[model samples]
Target: MQSCSSALCVLILLITTVTTSSGSASLSVTVKLNDSATLPCSERCSGLVTWTVSHKPTDVLAECDQTSCRSVKEGYQMIHDQYLKGNLSLTITDADFTKRDWYTCTCNNKDICDVALQLEPLRSSVQMKPGETLVLDLDVSDPVEVIYNSRANGSSGHICIVDRGSLECTVEYAQRASLTSALELKGVTPSDSGVYTIQVTRTEEVIHVYTVTIQDDLPHPDRDQETVVPVWGIILLILLVVLMGGCFCNVVVLQRRRNIMQRWRKTDGQRKKEKKKEKWLSLT
Candidate 1:
């Protein structure tokens, strides 16, 4: 009878342990570089709340009891006002690649939740001329593999896998595709214009999903026509100003000549009147 009781107790203990270990809920959060990210905890817990790095359980990230909050990590802190309202969410400022990891949140010294921090995907587009090279700018700081996919032509494959500063590529893409600070594809054609999806992987797990649209290059504006039009306009304006000035000078000169002729005629008439007066006075 005692053996049967012991066996039943052991079974119950095993069940409880499994339940506690797997029952903890997990939350995923995506944050941009240099931005702030929040890891949510329970809002109803009143006692002590502790956050730790999941892989390194001994590393405490932050802690908040009923009365106060403190941070053990450099960039992590608990919102004070939220803590007063029973929200024990942790905020990490200036998030970067080094901050991406699994974190555990425990309330009352019991593991209650887990958080997965991921980097936000960057979305952009690239324009390239036919038979020209295409560059996909991936401003990544950590090790990652880039999977390139085309939606229109169904040319979906990985461009390169970069791990710890080492790069490897498949045989088909080895000749045309290369990895510098970014992914570059040589001799792209019009058929390559489509929606390209970039999947950044770390340890075979996708950490970021970026969308890039490939399109034909925009036609360059006719710069010569633009320059010529403005130059002609300025030349016409200057010519119009000179013509107006010439017309004004001619009108002034004609007016002055007419005034001088009228003055000469008046003087001649006065001389004739004087001669007639002198002849009449001598006869009298």
Candidate 2:
């Protein structure tokens, strides 16, 4: 009876481990956007080996046979040489947010390994002046929560939610917050400077992190003087153009009077000659 009990306990433990391994991912691989990632699964298989995602088990991502290896989907592949050496790793040429999920590898239709492909948070840095708008990319289609940490107060809280391509914000940001592909705040002040984290609402996995710095709207000592110089320069330019135009008009008027006086003098000289001829003819 003791032997039976010990055997039973061992069997139960083995069954538990097998179940957990099949249901959960044994490895977690995180990579940045557009970076290549290799999900390692070293197991020799004489027959065909296949890789599939948990979301769609029927769809194959990569497959390999003893003769050769091929990728069923674009951007995913299994190296032929590596597979021959018992390395059944799935290589993603470009890791993206859309490809993040739990992936499974099978040899001859038997599950051999499970891996979680997670995407690293997209980091962003922003610098803006007071009264300017702030925008942070959500970077995921699924529902997510945006948490804001204030730089001044060193406090943090949920600021917004993204769902079904829409957004909802807290009471403090309700009037100013909007969303499209990203979360936008209409008028941000220095107090609003801080980090904004966008994470999955259900899983709480971070998708995006933004560090925002809002510069203070301090008054410049020469602010008025700087503006006044441009205004004065513009006024002086206008006055100079007007003075040049007046001088041109005065020269035109004087030239026109001089032409009229010359014509009158020529006419008077011709009339005096005609009178002298008439007096000489009358004397004759």
Q: Count of backbone clashes for each model?
A: 0, 0
Q: What does candidate 2 score in Cα RMSD to the true structure? A: 8.1
lDDT of 2 at 207: 92
Q: Pick by TM-score: which candidate is best? A: 2
Candidate 1 residue-wise lDDT at 148: 62
- Model 1 accuracy (lDDT, Cα): 0.76
Local distance difference test scores for all models: 0.76, 0.89
> Model 2: which ten-residue window has the lowest total lDDT?
217-226
Among these predicted structures, which one has the highest lDDT? 2
Off by over 4 Å in 2: 1-11, 17-25, 217-284
lDDT of 2 by residue, 1-284 (tens): 99999999999999999988665347889998999999999888999999999667789999999899888899999988998899999999999998889999989988888899998898889887788889888777889999988899899999888899877888999999987677889888888989999999999999989998888755544775666667788999999999999999999999999999999999999999999999999999
What shift in Å separates residue 73 of candidate 2 from its native position after superposition?
A: 1.3
Model 1 alpha-carbon miss at residue 62, Å: 2.6
Cand. 2 TM to true fold: 0.71
lDDT of 1 by residue, 1-284 (tens): 99999999999999999987767878899888789999887656778788888988778888887678898888899876787787778889888867878999887767888899887765665565676777766555566666766657677777677665676778866788777777777887666665544444644545455544444655534754665667788999999999999999999999999999999999999999999999999999
Q: What is the lDDT of residue 74 in candidate 2?
A: 91
CA lDDT for candidate 2: 0.89
